[model samples]
Target: MKQYNIAIEGLDNGSFQQQGCDTVLRAALRAGIGFPYECNSGGCGSCKYEVVSGEVENLWPEAPAVTERDRRKGRLLACQCRATSDLVIRMRPQPEAVPVIAPRRMPARLLEVREVTHDLREFRFGTETPASFLPGQYAMFALPGVSSPRAYSMSNTASGGREWHVQVRRVPNGKATEVLFEKLRPGDELEIDGPYGLAYLREDAPRDIVCVAGGSGLAPMVSIARGASQAGLLKDRHLHFFYGARTPRDVCGESFLRELPEFGERIHYHPVVSMPGEGENAWRGETGFVHELLRRRMAERMSECEFYFAGPPPMTNALQEMLMLEHRVPFAQIHFDRFF
Candidate 1:
């Protein structure tokens, strides 16, 4: 039985003990150390880290985000690699560090659930203990009879209370969605854990912040934007939101977004539709994919602005590529959470 010390450098956050056989990221999470990551399956590059010291074995050789250049530079996807020895990895800052709170598990009871669109549902639940999380962070919930927990981002920031909210889409056979839409009822108890993710708004973000959200991805952006508005953070910073949907019927949370503009004219909103149905031609807003629309409008200043996005893999992946390769936006300036 061998355990290794995993030291994450450059943050006051110290080190943790990890089993030699487990991925560094997994061990970090299990150790309750807040680290940057999303799509822990290695589909997204959020967990890519430079191995400052020690060695690791690639547990998942087919990591899509790891490049040959990354390997040459000693970078590995933390989610796909297990530490072979005591390790020191230089990593990103923990988003919530004013005072960090480790992930916790608790019991939650379903309070209310309602359909928001043809495919989207809004759910309200109360945790057994009050929980606090960053605006764009998410929680993992294990429903009764389900073998695994499903992650859902909060639609609002942690209010330092027992209640929280999330928006879900009806995936044809998604375990949590099915349980939420078909079997779950108000007062059903479930196991919950987390407040995980790295796509949240940074306190030091530039004066101009751009958010692009597709489908239910708008949930977290709404949370960030609303939180900023409520805390008076938007007064000095410009907030621009691009929300996309497949059709008019798929749009959700218009009223919540509408209030953002009242924060000030600097708060802008773009609701784009990818496909407009018959008689929907009268719509005067942007069209096509959200990334394309953003490129058309902000291609000139993208390299200078900070960007955050949350959405389906296709949307987030394409947008990240477009911003980095085409717009020349710095990799460090773009943050994303890709929902699988």
Candidate 2:
């Protein structure tokens, strides 16, 4: 195996090593370097880097962030590139002041599981030592006899206790969800790793916060809401939370949203039901896409606010497109996490 040295400029001249064909981003992660990234699948542009020297190959030839101009300028998506030779690159730096906990892989025992809604279940995993994670980040859980680990965001803020909380939405025939919803029980042991993703709350932003979540996407939003409330970040800023579900039966976190009153009028909650099912209906809440509701509520103020959204691809993509194209919200003011 041919191994080459990798240097990341502007990160204190940090360096790591990668075997031939390994991406620079993977090398950094393996070396415990907390480089900025989201959606490590080469979709999000958070890992864009400028190749300073040596050869590398783009794994995704059509990376969205790498344009013809960018290719001419020697820029590539770190998540989509592999070092073909010893290389020097400068990646977009993560927020210097952000508190990013290093990831660790270890065993955790299932402590409890309960249905939070018709299709969502709250999972509690107990670790030997208290696990610390930024609000809005996720951990990967590998069930017994399962070959691949499944990633789920924590639904609660970091705590001194040794338990991690996650909410999972059952997917049709999904192996992990099948096991979680049917065959898993308290006291079952599972392996977990992380505190990954860069979509955590930026508590220092000077603008109001608007967050949108759909289905189990409410997990990280739960963490952000509670953490912001406890940190007093909502005292002077308005927090408009919009959660969407197919029907009222799919809605979770009603009690969780009810607690926002503790933060006073600055905090607001809007639960949207997109497709109310036929039960001889009596649903009273905003109806239609959550982004449409957001456009109706604060369309004019989007430019002045910081937006955080996480959900299935279609919803998140639509919302992001609306915010960026229609509302003209600055790209810097909007952040997202998509559960694919």
Off by over 4 Å in 2: 1-12, 17-27, 30-36, 41-99, 260-264
lDDT tens readout by residue for model 2, 1-340:
8898888766665888886444677567757666666765566666778888898877777866567887787777776778888888877555541336766667899999877887888999999978888778888787766654667899888757787899999899888888998898899888887767777888888899888898888988888888788778887888888898888788766677677655447778888888866656756777898889999999889899998888888999999899999989998788775545
Sliding window of 10 residues with minimal summed lDDT for model 2: 91-100
TM-score of each: 0.77, 0.79
Tell me the tens digit of each residue's lDDT in model 1 across 1-340. 6899888887665688877445677678767765667766677677888888898888766678888888788788887777788988987746442124566667899999877788888898898778778777787777777754677888876767787788888989777778889999998888777767767767666557888889888788888887777667777778878888888777656667776654447678877888867664545566788898898888788887888888888998899889989888888888777756
Steric clash pairs (candidate 2): none
C-alpha local distance difference test of each model: 0.77, 0.79
Best by TM-score: 2
Best by lDDT: 2
